[model samples]
Target: MSTEISIKDAAKQLNISEQRVRTLCRQGELESRKFGNSWIINAESIDKYGLRTAHMVAEDHPAYNVNEKCKKPIALSFFSGAMGLDLGIEKSGFDVRLACEVDKYCRQTIALNKPDTALLTDINKYSANEVRLAAGLGKDEEIDLIMGGPPCQAFSTAGKRKGLNDERGNVFLKYIDLALELRPKYFVIENVRGLLSCPMEHRPHEKRGDDYPELGLDELKGGALNFIINRLENSGYSYSFNLYNSANFGTPQIRERVIIICSRDGVKPPYLVPTHSEFGSDGLQKWNTVKKAISNLTSHDHLTFPEKRLKYYRMLSAGQNWKNLPIETQKEAMGKSFYSGGGKTGFLRRLGWDKPSPTLVTHPAMPATDLAHPVEDRPLSVQEYKRIQEFPDSWDLAGPIIQQYKQVGNAVPISMGNAVGKLIMNLLKGNEIPSFNNFKYSRYKNTSDKEWKEQFSKQVLKHKESTEQKELGFG
Candidate 1:
């Protein structure tokens, strides 16, 4: 239900006159309803109007500033969306001294929440020395850690799968170059699960078939990661990476990411320790559920689905989706999509009160990836998105409501960040690292560096053998 307040309340909230509020209502600048003659405004409309009409809430502070009093190990952040990962590291005692973000709203978010951290706009415009100085360090001051995930669209399965050939891919290399130049004692890189299989060189689909020649080394799946490993290795950095699900670290979402850790001293930190597990197995806590994540909220502000989609949502219960619809209803609801392949599980789905949410998408109402609330008629709220990502409720998110959702959706789960941060502390402090062997970080196999490399080597050997037999006409 929409929250409504009198015009006087709306005017007071915006610090504008009653006449101006009514003018906005008449102009359709705010959402207003006339009940028996008096105008009542939607409370959310007031907030949105205030945010756009005047200087943003983020304008209260400087865009960037350095903290001279920071005493924790220094971490420099890049591609710092909402500082979700950095927050986790901070929990484990590292100070993120600088944040470099390119997005406008993300910069606003950084300035709003991390006023003390120096903020830079474009990484490409700065040199190693510039980045260091901005972090409040001297020319030769050692960097404790450099952490970021460069844009992953180049390697994302959902995109063109361009790998490092795209312009964004070049930036990915530059981030590593910056790390190598600054020579941080430790660094962390995080990305989507698809990076494991993206090729170093992407070949267009039309160019491949039975008539095409055998795949080149650089064109094979895993080639992209192999090239990254080689580049870091050549730079004298020893790295370890694995696919990990955020839920294992106690995040209330089943989001998986590839985390790569590189050490200047060649000391490898073990994989992240799991704080919870599916079904409470191995004596860990049970996975955090959507019900638990949002149960404390007294009210929710959310976007709504069209009446057509709502018809399907109303038919389904918690944890149910289009699969639960009757046969004819399924066809009507899905239309052409009903006959298309795959589970179509994301269609008209509702979150399960007893289960963790599916991965949070940038847009919660996308047809193929809706993240509806368990019992509500609307999609999950921005407040609920923050909670599931493990961000503190008071952590200010600045921007339009849609942009707020994108920011929260793209953040590294605070639990995942905390895990990485705790591990980094142990490694840097000379404590014995916790080791869990054969742990199912995700549902995939051969994802560890050791196993993945071995498997790739086998593929290369198999290709070579097949080529030799083909040339020799063994058949």
Candidate 2:
């Protein structure tokens, strides 16, 4: 399986000392043969040992690069929360050279995991020179990709639909600025689906006896995403934006996101291919259930509830809600909420043992959106949240147990991250058409709540000397 070469030749090829080569061979990190007067090593053995040689291939296999067969591409990530997306992309073969984030806990999480990686606090404060330095490259180093999901609350369905003026919306714009400044070969913009309909400006009302502003959808010029696309196109980047269902990409949760991909070189727009289907014929693959993600986690002993909330979720069977309870019991449990008209689906709900989990929120045990466990009377545990989000068991999350739950709950799932990373890799490799026939987001059974006070206390104690925490007012 390996070509035979002399020890001196192998050392010369690998650009290392013969002593080092011999040491590696002695330790079995590399294999060699001794024939009468000389030592010979196999080419395959050199490759297996990842020894860098001038003539032979010293880099990773072409198939291993997600960019398909192109040269190894480097990346820079922003708003890198717990680095779930970055982790997946790195696994898929893109070299993430540097990361940017503002949250203290998230920064801690990134430091804990990727200690060797260069991490900066804020994208706004980062300069091109600093970025180059952090990447350990010169100013002319080729940056293949820049990816990020700016906070979407400003463009979320629940927030005020203020487009570019909202501070958070400006942050998204800042990400655009960075992209233009860096001019990476590829760029990604991620946000909530509400960006499709969020208004740019409020319509003015006709002059009346008393002056007051009138608001209507027709009065707005366009959605936030329209402006975003226009800006990207104007910057000389050919781009495409679409709504992607995370379920289609192997995440158990049915989370949908608006993702935009842009390229500076005017290449074909990359579309992610799903690799798993919930109800497909292959049968070798199926949508992962909540149980599959979390069944292995040990249950927590204490059933802690949020502060000042005497109400706790009453355990129920699968596919059952508050309506399943005795009529009198329902009325007593729901109180005034029972008298309300709309479908109060959150009341007394239990996750099915076989389905995917619903969208996880900051607090899982809120009365209006109760996510009680099927068998247990309490909410889901902190470890369970990480599993549902596809975070590795060995991954360490910072902050108190409650804050950790909140951070993980708000993250993009790792399975979906992996799919996106692979797609980006394909783009880097010049794969024009990628297969995505298998993505599906299936529903499953899944819960959490501890009080803000307790979580804050724990965070303060946990990061008493954190400089970023003090600067960000998180202290």
Candidate 3:
């Protein structure tokens, strides 16, 4: 016997009702033997017949509280760093009743922002029961969606690409487990693009030799994404995943992420089509420009500029890098980097007055990756960073000024979140999908705000100028 389970246990384990499990047993969808007056199922049969859906496990079935109407769905957030994703989801139109995050700083941040929603201290210490209590629903309530992107450090291209074996990578797996336990209708897993090509370990053959590489402290013995997908499929869900650029979804910065959508319902998995394009074509809109995002804000004193560096950037023009500097000044200002290989593009780089900004990393003043204001001579301040990233002015971030800058810079843009939120709302409401595949927002619909109209119109004019320049073949 390979860990036999009762038929009722099988039903609970698979996140379905006992009545359905009994039917499966009768119809040969499940394997069960009579024990006492009831049927008992073995682990093998459980694996064979059970469906593993995202966000809900067999244990979570008891905690489900949704009725057949599937009214308001509760969300369970995992690896909830700074709650950027959660904020976007909420803004778009879902209720986030509970969140699980491990970092003390992030937790404090969450508490500051959303004091009423139940938040778990550590993801590992939480179970489905805890989630239900926090969500203010019973085990029988159906959680509509489970969402989160575990910390992306281990899976990022900038990092070692350690995949599932990294301790941080294990949190990704734990997210899957919670989804299965909760049996939510859908789940969204967000990660970096590197997950598509991360090298993973093969499932070991029972009798095979043990020459595998040393696994990390809590890393799983398989490729991170693959292991996560396999477990979800085994538990009974269909998943669709792809990489998307934040700029395409109205974010001012050029950031890309891989979004994985999973569902238990046997339907086409929802995919997010691009809503903003770099260049308009076939009625698609161009990407949002950095100027459109932050041009209006009055310049506050920048946070990082020492007196000397600040004076230097003041001399540069928007869209000009060190290459535009006088040859003598370039050598003197750039120092060793002037002789370095590859495009030291960031050296003295200034944002183009008409184009979207590059990704904002933790530090803006980093050599070879300067993010100086187009007109000002210094790196952007915390307020400006938040404005560019689309975070509300009222949203509070906890930390020192630099720490605040880092957190805000690391955040997913609010506009991108809004886009994702709209799509999610449409999906949950069973409405016709919005025009996501099409990218230009300017021509879609007119807004009534005079200032917004003026701002957006100005960018259109600048974009037209750039287009004409391209037509003339100007560099």
Best by TM-score: 1
Q: Residue by residue across 245-356, what tens digits does model 3's lDDT show?
A: 7877777777777777887785556566566677865455787887887878874635566665655676778988888878998888888878889888877778886887
lDDT (Cα, 0-100) at 386 in candidate 1: 93
What tens digits encode model 2's per-residue C-alpha lDDT throughout 1-475? Answer: 5478778877887778888888877777667877776567886666434422212332211112122234557888889888877877787888777778887667667666665567787777777767777666567877888889998788787876666778888888888987888899888887777765666653433442224332333224344665676677788898765566666667766677766788898764756676656675444356667777777777552235453233424445765778877788788878899999989987666666686777776667777776666666667776777777778887867666666766777777777777777877787777766544332322321000112224434544544445355557654
Locate the minimum summed-lDDT window of 10 residues in model 1: 54-63
For model 1, name the residue pairs that clash.
none
Question: What value of lDDT does candidate 3 attain over all alpha carbons?
Answer: 0.68
Candidate 3 Cα misplacement greater than 4 A, ranges: 1-71, 201-222, 299-301, 434-475
List candidate 2 segments past 4 Å from native. Answer: 1-71, 202-222, 281-284, 299-303, 306-315, 435-475
The order by descending lDDT is: 1, 3, 2
- What's the CA error at residue 157 for candidate 3, in Å? 0.9
lDDT, candidate 2, equals 0.67
Report the Cα lDDT for residue 404, model 1.
Answer: 89
Identify the candidate with maximal lDDT. 1
Higher-lDDT candidate among 2 and 3? 3
